[model samples]
Target: MAAVTDAAGNPWFSWDYVQSNASALLAALIQHVELTAASVLIAAVLAIPLGILAYRVSWLTGPILALSSVLYTIPSLGLFAVLAPFLGLYASTVVIGLVLYALLVIVRNTLTGLNQVPVEIRDAARGMGYGKLGLLTRIELPLSLPSIMTGLRIATVSTVAMVTVGSVVGGYGGFGELILEGFRNNFYKAQIMTATIATVLLALVFDLVLALLGRLATPWSRRRAS
Candidate 1:
């Protein structure tokens, strides 16, 4: 049974609920990570390239950035609904929604990091026989890694939370299901516990990973400290 009787006639943590459904819980969490990772990774790949191109071309900057920023203002559910027909009732819609959500931050930060590079340093790279690509790869890319990483970290956290909306469209995975199930069943504690645990744990995990990456990418900042 999903619920059981206690000795005193009060139900406790339903061992059957967890044990019988352990696989479902694991599957849901795994699907959550899969959806989140695919969206974020795709956004990173596409945004970095487009952002770099945007930085290089002054004419493209205003329009491209404005368009991506507009994507951020749209509600997540609305975006999913609009794309659902085309992508169908699956994780593709979720991935597309999340990717759109991530683009503005990623592109803006990439541009910011590239623009923040010192003019004199760039000139020196050119003087040292570096071409545009060489200067970008060796000088601009390394220097900008820290800021880009910051953008990615923010995107990851945001996407992790935002992905809960995916289940609303029938993706059938993630902590969203836990919250939904709890709501439908009037199990407030279940909803609160799963939501809280998923949020806190995901945020902490990503934040620490990004912190380490930031420190590694910008070791010169450490020298300034010591």
Candidate 2:
């Protein structure tokens, strides 16, 4: 009575299909969230320090950004292909690729935020007897919170999209597997549309969550704007 029913005359969607595949959909969605969150977090952890180092050491900025730029230019499929032999066909390969891809934006944004801190502010902090480490921890970082959060939000959304490409490697692609399955299974209308819709929705939801987190983290930004 289910599976595929053209007799209902609507091929674009199927309530029966969604209801039948609910568990699979939930599993895929969970995997998608895990992949996106892990990649963005790892990227942020690495990028922030690298950004700080580059900002501190004037000579390193070119090389650091250049490397991220190179990583960014590599195609997602190509990056996965490169990592497959080392990481194999697992989530790790996808995660490493995502982390690399996320670096450019996050690192650039971090550096930008640090640079945006006025020179006079640094001098003022120094006048208040704050050392370099203390000044950065107490002043520069807090002021740069908005920019860093913006980069994280952007990286998170992009990572969510890139995660679908991982389906090419394995089940690690989350909802991506559903999309691929739909394509392979004679263009299963409900599966294809459902997975596609879910992907877009997931990205939107992640963006909204990050936006909220960013606002909460940078209450000063709101007050300044007001």
Candidate 3:
């Protein structure tokens, strides 16, 4: 094994060190994904329904969306600070705060998706004796899938980046925790490597997933393979 020393006489990171500790690094990355996915899914489950209801009622959209917007205006750290006393300094506080930040994007996209369902198509579905639920499930949802997928893509990317905020509360370990530890301990390469890998990997994976989803949701939009 090779030994490397830093400017402060502390042990510095090297490729060999990262390779030797691959298992722990992998575990941290998985934990980070779990935390980010859980938070986004919870928020989506809540926001999607709220958006649908807001669209259906016509009168509720203004006030309800405004309220969601107001929530978005609150700083993540400030929100976490307020929630920590009740939730305790834990992953839950960070999850709650991140979810709140995601609400506007999810809800607005949901509303846009639902509204984009053509009125003519909806009326025709109704004329064919489709019930409200049938129209929504069979007609509206499928047609609006592209928009909804767009929302999910946006939310997932945002949430992945924001999960770093979790490290402040001992939420989960991953690249963010690595970066935080590095900076706090003045390990510049650790900070740079972790931050770079996390950011690049997050963006790449999410963008690829979103592209695949877009194709699945809109078959008509897909181009023929040469």
User: By lDDT, who's the top model here?
Assistant: 2
Winning model by TM-score? 2
The models' CA-based lDDT, in order, is 0.82, 0.91, 0.77
- Which ranges of candidate 2 are over 4 A from the true structure? 1-10
lDDT by residue (117-206, candidate 1, tens digit) is 999999989999999999989999888887898889999999888888887778544877776776677554534455547656876787
Off by over 4 Å in 3: 1-14, 171-173, 220-226
Over the full model, what C-alpha lDDT does candidate 1 score relative to the true structure? Answer: 0.82
Model 2, 84-195: lDDT tens digits are 8877998888899999999999999999999999999999999999998999999999998888988998999889889999998888998999999998998887898889
* lDDT comparing candidate 2 with the true structure: 0.91
- Per-candidate TM-score against the hidden true structure: 0.87, 0.93, 0.85
Candidate 3 is scored at a TM of 0.85
Model 3: per-residue lDDT, tens digit, 16-98? 65777677677767877777787888888998888888888999999879989999898766776688778887777777888
Please report the TM-score between candidate 2 and the true structure: 0.93
What ordering of candidates by lDDT runs from best to worst? 2, 1, 3
**RMSDs, each prediction?**
4.1, 2.7, 3.5
